[model samples]
Target chain A: MPPLVLHHLSVNYQDLRALRNINLTIHPGQLVGIFGPNGAGKSTLIKAMLGLIPRVTGRVTWGEADLSAHLERIAYLPQRSQIDWHFPATAWDVVMMGRVKPTGWLRPFAASSRRLAQAALERVGMAELAHRPIGALSGGQQQRVFLARALAQEAEIFCFDEPLVGVDQATTGIIFKVFRDLAAAGKMVLVINHDLGESITNFDQLILLNQELIAAGPRQWVLSPEHMRRAYGGEVGFWGHVA
Target chain B: MLPEMGPIHWLLDPLQYDFMLRSLAVAVMVGIICAVVGSYLMVQRLALLGDAISHSVLPGLALAFWLGGNIFLGAFIAGVLSTVLIAWIHRQSSIKEDAAMGIVFSAFFALGITLITVIQKENKIDLNHFLFGNILGVTVADVRDTAIIAALVLGVVVLIYKELLFYSFDPMGARASGLPVGLLNSGLMVLIALTVVASMKVVGVILVLSLLITPGATAYLLVPRLHQVMILGCGIGVFASLSGLYLSYYFNLPSGAAIVLVVSALFSLAFLFSPSQGVISRYRRRP
Candidate 1:
């Protein structure tokens, strides 16, 4: 059975249909990259998968079990711009929040949770800055911090929206490596991305979406000239090497 | 001319009275609660919400006072109802929260003032005191009510600290995480109402805005976490309360006004000296 299945998912916002009759299945250990233009329902798909939007009409299942049964097994990292980074929380505290529901209220964070937060930060090479306020970090560093926070969740299914935006080349490489490692560990990783060319090489499967699924399959099979034209409203062009 | 034989001699002797002790207790309780909750609101950029809620209680205060019932009960109902109205209007309509807040607070406060003027027909009901409280008139019931309300508010805040932080930092993320963001938002408003009424006697309606915002803003300069900031803010608030009361007695001045002044002074001092986020830290002296 596939790890995640979205069947006939339709989402509406007022008069506009953000997504219509979208159907897809992501198998276990697959690194799926969704490429689309603006207003092409990339982030909307992630939100629907997480049950964020109430107006969604669809059936989502995970590992042959109901999607709602595995709330703790899925981790989602929203776009970096959706947060108020000026909040007076340290990077460690923000990461520690991932352990809160499991630790229960009134109990102080366990030593294991602290170690895990530190380890997650170290994974993103941000362990040394744990004590720093989140507001003090640069945009790329802030993204890394949030990624560490999401990593601390230790979920089997990971979804990241535009994790590569506004980030340096080194951080991008680190993030891709982490995604590859997670996928190799028999976990599913889905990325809503816009870099069409690099996505073709980095992702094991490509899901081209434009308010609907334009194409889906192995990257080499689905990223042909005809599929690119449909997804991009024209030929998908790559001018310069990805930074 | 001896400072030890201070001008507050007469007022200090009043501490021997039970009413005076109750008044002081009520003031301190209100101070701690406001500082604890206010720290989060200030850091989360909701300082104006506190002010809006406080003024929004005016109509309720007038209604309760007119009915010859407990003023807090009225303000509690009025504050919560008005806050919900503002939140709903903001979400369901084109009006922004600021516009909703402006309209709601102004309408409530205006209605309160009008009621007071028309009903009392004079300042005999101590409208000024309610606007700017007089700590000297606190009763035993007032002290008990303040203690209970403060405890309840604090308990709720601590219990939901993680959820509140999550929502404040990123509402979309928190919603996606399946937190009840709407319920938490309403709970915050209710907590604010309880806090405003509890503080009615100490800082009065007029200067209570200072007590709500100052200690938290001061603590924000020194602390990096919400919990620590709240603790520090509470400490600053209590200290300001104690010092303000004592200084007011010694100087023969208003206790509530004195407390706000001291708290503001402390914020000014923090703004000057804090290392990382202080105003002075942002600028360097030319060598």
Candidate 2:
């Protein structure tokens, strides 16, 4: 698979610059985590890269072509808070949404798509509750359902924004395991993470940010004291396992 | 005293008149399309936008009447224009969407009322008919126009059901998945405008919001899926329209107000007695 590259990406919210010139290349088979403090544009970075939001200046490329033109190969899970849990849809319905574009416009989902959705639900241990309304699920279960949806997409690139927030330990374990499995299968995985705990160790690479690209490299290099100080604006303490 | 008529006779009595037949046809078609399109508005928390568009169509109606153009086409154009103006205002400034909708819709409604009052002097037009609906005045041409709009709206909805479902549930995710979200949003607006314009002669601009939102909301209280909500809402809307027309015929009530009242009554029943999400059910389950 071709690597994903971002060239001089920038985003602005009115007069405020949310993200500065960001340039990075993400290779396949890597589980990448984006780390930043509150308001650090971590979510903005993923959104801009995928063209979910307007980019002031940037180009995202998957191989030689513009990434926007090939969005079918991407599976993106937005922050849970951004979703309307009260929407009148069951878990099965949401998971089926992943198959909509692939099923082609004006065509209904095939039996194969149903099988994929069922398998994805089973993989997330949510098969028993597939018919439950999404709003009725617990936070962890809801996150897992969304993960199942992403899994059903069968995409080459996966981008999840804060998938671990407010989730239970079982969900966290399942998510990291899935991330690892995707990387092992040579799929590109990018996650926006808020916790600076031992969970940071699960990532193969780290992109530290504070309105700009502070550092982008292996976990150890990105977590260096100088980079952490520069990114967090102070000397910060994190899980020793990260170092 | 004349011989008492049976229930079937009472029901079939109104069908003998050409006007009642046309009115009923228009009402039933309007009811089905409104409920289907209104499900989107209900789910997206854009009920106010429905009200906005309904009210905004008035100016277009008056302008079309003045220009001797197709009134439905004018109403559709005006409804769409109001939505665009609302979006533009909210996006260009810090004003929130609800506030923007209120400002634009009211301004357009005022302009419409003013234009209609001025035009009523020369033509045999009644502003009250537009405001409260004159379903009895529906012609065969009106019935035909409504049928075409209903078919067009339902066809597009069926054709793009999954895309619309995904986009409504998660716009950012849909866009990230390579769906043209902007176009989908605009398409939804167009569908809503068409629904609103078609519904005008049956419910009028003032009460159209009730048809657009109440039935969907009533179904939402009983169903867990969007499609089920739409289906149930359609049933509820058609029943209300039919029964409301009957009530109007028997009791000499205004057609549009009677329909709105019937729909609201159905919503109240669902709110109070629905099995899963009703107030009474929740209260009963609490102990």
Candidate 3:
């Protein structure tokens, strides 16, 4: 439950400036949403924080400690398209991957780890399809399986990149329910979402970006019409979650 | 001749010859190592890297021959070097990895071919043995070397199975979880190189690509886990090796080509009849 701080972060992909001069402090118990149009560097920011990508400048610290030093307590769910659905792994196998770090090398998964994985599957409503190969599952089912993987990790800080895209309504509901529960339990939950529909209301805080920080704060203060125009270019509608 | 011989005699008669016995032991060991290392290559979608590394080992083999050093060690060094060059080229330039692999491997392969030709004029070694393999020419030392490599490869795989599994399945996730992906990747490259060097006598450089990729791919159709794929692929590889050896003995065929054909035939069977992912069943599904 430590606060995370980002100081003057920037990323360069060759000549392109993906993220520029970003700074923020994220506290626990917040369900944070990173919203922007395509190419806004939403996914890159998260990757950079976790050191999945090397940042050109700046630093990220989790409660006065380097984020890399505390990676075991973090769980990341990559976007769906980034994964090969045709990979020859069952849903149970994917969830068990969450237990991999804790289970470590030269050893097998403990009984407790297996029980945790089973519980995660049940929590995500995918227990019945646990034995099914990942390729056989629909888009929504795949996302749910990944969510279950994150839950099985028992991580303190959970980050998801586009978890709701192309999923069914049932899946959306279940995911939001779980995110809320995770936040309520004093865990820091960060999500990268491109959707601005009804689901945007679930966030406790919002960080809008379009290659640079637009505005970041409580949802109400961050989603003003002015900020919306700067991030999405012109009016992009605000029917579902805008108050 | 084999038709008249009982299956027991067909199997037992080979044991009388010391050279055949050495070939048999080396063939089995190569089968296991190739399948084990090849499983990782298949799952990572780096099958071409297998081709790249196999071809890249040539320059090393040539250089070792020139320097009066162990060709096997040279091949391993060149194999690892090619991967590093490929990675460096990919990162430093805008070129895609596949393109980088294509450029590096062909250049190294060409260098190897030229060097071998130059050396062959002065030496008595047949270039065919390096290109297509001569399993019948294996010695007791070859058997011992293959055994050691097999043990090392299987031991590392056992020790790091979980990390490799996690890394191959989701590299981004593995990196985020603090696993040293660069080291793991290099370790895998080293293993793949060792497998290629160990397999040179059983199936030469040009054909080792098939041994490295085909068995795992065949098993992938039938199994649903990485380890299962490796275990079943090893079985398929060993079966192909033994059957090919037997076929060569009875029919006066080239052992390497015969083994490759047996493996290809087995791959066709799995492609058409595997329970979960067979073409026959999958094609039968309708909207």
Candidate 4:
């Protein structure tokens, strides 16, 4: 588990600058949260690190290796809206997609891959619905299915974008528990969160950004009054205290 | 003084005519490839892209005809060009993809129709033959061409099935998993163009979208997986093509039009009665 490092990262969506030169290092065994207000580059920060979008500047590396070259060792969950739920695949089929790269091309999935996929579904409490159409599932169930898919990848780095959006309480609890378990097992877990809600307490570390990094460290260290004001104005400190 | 044959004889009698054999060969090949490739389009919500490429191929056909070159190659190039142009326009501007497709395809289609109409006035070639198709008049050369394209399309689909399935279901995830998304996307565009070009001789550009989309959609209503949708769609496409070909033979109707009609009729049946997702099934489950 190499430390994920981003040095001088910047992103531009056409003429609008979405993120400025941002530097950070995420060590193994840490569950980190990227927090920001709307249009504050929280999502852009993750996408830039993963090289998903066109970068205006900088590179990302995992220890000595380039991140792009090591993408297969990472598991990523995009925002829910990025998926087409109406596609004809079932939960079992989708979880099996995680094994595609590992199984390689021009060959069928191994029996072990099937066992892993089924175990992933069982973990997410979606085992019974493995054969149901994805479109028929509730929003929370859909999110759980995707999480199971990422888990089945068995990667050292787990990246999620807005995983908690529109999900029920049970799914959120299960997701956080799994994230903690992965972190305890020495995996690099990075999450993009949109709110200063009750769930903020679950993150072990925090990277506060508003177009740039205002502060990043342990949760208590990054949530100071001064840092909060710099990132999201003074009013946010009140919301933070409430949470 | 009438001649009569058994039902089996009537069905088998068509195989005795060389022209009928050629038409049936083209129909089956077109059906197989269309259903297979069209399943991708249906899942990606790009069914209209099939229509767009089909229409855009007309100019290529007219130009190739004028140049006394291969119409299939010309139409294929034109179809791919249309998709590229659509992607370029959509990416480089504020225009959405749907609007971009509409703008580019209509322009190419108009150019093609104008060129073909003008060429028709001077040559013995009939414009209606290209617009409505002359499946019964397909040469052995056309059958061979269709077979080659069908084999190529089905081969590529089989070779890249799992990767394509992952990409189609969640492209961002596939890319994040280190798949060559750009290459897969380009290959899909090429496959789509080939399917459209091969189909033009059987259903014509104006009606080819139905063959490319209807059967897949019909199967989608009854299935729970992408590959199943494609296989079932192929089966439905073959059945409809056979029945429609026979109906046309008995009633003196246009073979291509009759085939499309049969395909749509099957789709309507699936829409109404598929057990898992159909309107009738849902209504019954509600009570």
Candidate 5:
């Protein structure tokens, strides 16, 4: 697969510059993490790249085409908080949503789609609770269900925003294992992560940001004290001790 | 006279009148379509948008009558325009959506009331009929128009069920996964406009929000899935319409008010007694 590339991406919220002049190249078979202090445009970067939100200036290309033109190749898991847990859908119902674009318009889900959704639920250990309402699931279980949805999309690129927040260790393990499996299969996996704990070790590369690209390289290089201090300001001391 | 009639005759007596038959047919169709479309409004927490659109359609109705055009078409255009205006105001300015809706809908409503009041001085129209609905005055053409709108709304909804489900549940995920979020949103607005316009004669603009929200909310309390909510809501809406018409016939109550009252009662029952989410059930489950 051709690398996913961003050229001078920037985003503004009215007068406030949320992200500025971000450039990165993400290769296939890499599990990448984006780290930043709160309000550092971590989520904004992912959203801008995917064209979910407007970008002030940038070009995002996957292979030879604009990324916006080939969005079907992407599987995106938004922050869990962004979803309405009270929506009246079962775990199985949400997983089947992944097949909607692939199934094309005006056609019901075929038997093959149903099998894929079922397999995805089973992969997340949620098959037994397939019929349960999503609102009734625990936080970790809800996150797992969304993960199952992304897996069912069968896309070449995966983007997850804060999938680890408010989730259990078991859920975290399952998530990392799935991310690794996707990477091993030669798919690009990018995750926006809040924690810099031991979980940070799971990423093959890190992109640290504070309204701009502070550093982007292998995990250890991007986590260096100087780069951490630059991106996080005075909070670096807390992160340094943790690191 | 009451002692001589059987239960079946009492039920069948209303069917003898052609006007009653037309009203019943239109009411049933309105019930089904409103519940289906209203499920989306309730789930997305855009119940106020429904109220906004319904109220805003009045100006179109007045203008269409003044121009001798089809009032349903006019109302649909006005409803859609109000939503677009609300979105535009919200996006172009820092005004939040709820405030924008409030401003635009009330402005349009005021314009409608003004136009109707001025037009009624010369014409034989009654503003109260439009406000409260005159379902008994529905003509054959009105029934036919409502049927077509109902079919179109239900057909599009059925075809795009999964896409709508995904979009409504997680808009960012759906948009990122290649769905045309804007087109889907516009299509929903159009469907809602059609549903509101089709329902106007049965419930009036003032009370159509009740038909659009109450039945679906009642079913939402009882069911755990969107399709289930819609299906059950349809049943609830139709039952309320049928029973309310009967009560209106027997007690000489206004048809629209009677239907709204019945649907509200059903929602109250669900609120108090639904098995999973009801007040009583949750209270009973407590230790």
Candidate 6:
């Protein structure tokens, strides 16, 4: 059975169509890279998968269970600059947030939760800076901190949005290594990335999107010149301006 | 007989009066509730939320007085209703949050003043008192009301702590996590309303913003953790409440304003000397 399935999905913002006729299934342990230019509705597609957009008409199922009920089992890392970096919070504190479940609130983070958070930080090579404030970190370090937070979730399926944006080469390599490790462990890793040339060589599967699914299959089969032209050619200026 | 002098004499003498005891209880409850709720508001960057609610509550107070109903209940209802409206309009429009808050606060405040002038032209309630509380005027009922509201606000904050923090830090992520982002947002507004209503008697509707913003802001400047910020803010709030009340009794001033002023002073000091986020600290940290 597919790890995640989306059927007859359509996302609209007022009169504009963000996503149209999206149907796809992702299997477990697959490293799927969603590549598209600006306004390609890549983010919207992911948002729909996570049930973030209520205006969409579709069914998204995870295994046999309702996707809504199994949200805690999915770890999501948003765009790097989406949050207020100046927020007064420690790195460990931010990581501890991942250990929270939908139902537990009475007792604070337990010893096991703290150990998990610490291990996640250690995995991201952020153990030394666990006590540092989130605002004090550099761009790449912040991304790593979030990765650590997601790591603490220990979810079966991991979804990351623009995790490599503005990150340094070293940190980017570390993040991809983490992704590779997750995929190797039979966990699903989905990333919305713009770095096409590298993504072609790195990702095992490519989901080409331009407001709809242009192609979805093995990397070489889906990353053909035709797909790139369709996804990026017409929107070169638009993407450049936004980027 | 004149009140005794000396530190213990000054502090304990105020508690000797029944009204002072009531005022102290109300202020303590209000301080605790505001600090707890204000931490969330500060994190959400809805720093001006208190300002909006306090100003908007005037119309409700006027209407309640006109109807001969409970003034606190009217203010509570009015504060919650107007805040919901502001949040809804904000979500539905392209107008920025600051502009939206400004528009709602002015309209409601003007409507309140107009109603008060027209309805009670002969024996009007003192608007100044509402703006600045007379702590010595608090009664047993006010203390009871403050406790109940404080308890409710604290309960909700503790129950929905993670959900609220998740949304405040990462709204898109929270939405993606299948959390009810809209409901959580409204829940925060309701908490803010309850806090404002509870704090109104002690801090008054006018300077209530101080209790909501000052201690939290001061703590933010000094602390690096959310939990620490909350604990420090509550401590500062209680300290300001007690000290301001004692000072007011001695100086013949409004206790609420005095408390706010003291908290503001601490905020200034934190702004100047706090280790990491403070003005001096930031400069010190700079290479």
| Cα lDDT of model 3 by residue, A1-243, tens digit | 679999999998677899999998888898999999999999999999999988999899998788889988989999887888877689998999899888877898899999999999999999999999898998999999999989999999999999999899999999999999999999999999988877888999999999899999999888888888889886657532564
Among the numbered candidates, top lDDT falls to: 2
Best-first order by TM-score: 5, 2, 3, 4, 6, 1
Which pairs of residues collide in model 5? none
Please identify which of the two predictions, 1 or 5, would achieve the higher DockQ against the true structure.
5
lDDT (C-alpha, whole model) for all candidates: 0.81, 0.92, 0.89, 0.89, 0.91, 0.81
TM-score for each prediction?
A: 0.91, 0.98, 0.96, 0.95, 0.98, 0.91
DockQ list for all candidates:
0.53, 0.92, 0.76, 0.84, 0.92, 0.57
Candidate 6 local distance difference test against the native: 0.81
What class would a CAPRI assessor give candidate 3's docking? medium
User: Cα miss at B186, model 6 (Å)?
Assistant: 2.7
Q: Count the backbone clashes (under 3 Å) in each candidate.
A: 4, 0, 0, 0, 0, 0
Candidate 1 residue pairs that clash: B8-B250, B131-B205, B131-B206, B133-B204
Weakest lDDT window of 10 consecutive positions for candidate 6 chain A: A234-243
lDDT of 2 by residue, B1-287 (tens): 32389988989988998888898998899899999999999999999999999999999999999999989999999999999999999999999999999999999999999999999899988887778777676888889999999999999999999999999999999999999999999999999999988888878889999999999999999999999999999999999988888887787777889999999999999999999989998999996
Error of 4 at A178 (Å): 1.3
Q: Which ten residues in a row have the lowest lDDT in candidate 5 chain A?
A: A234-243
RMSD (CA, angstroms), candidate 6: 3.5
Give the per-residue lDDT of model 5 (tens digit) for A66-174: 9999899899999877888999999999999899999999898999999988998888899999999999999999999998998888999999999999999999998
lDDT of 5 by residue, B151-266 (tens): 99999999999999999988999999999999999999999999999888877889889999999999999999999999999999999988877777777777889999999999
Interface RMSD of each: 2.2, 0.5, 1.1, 0.8, 0.6, 1.9
By DockQ, is 3 or 4 better? 4
By lDDT, the better pick of 2 and 4 is 2
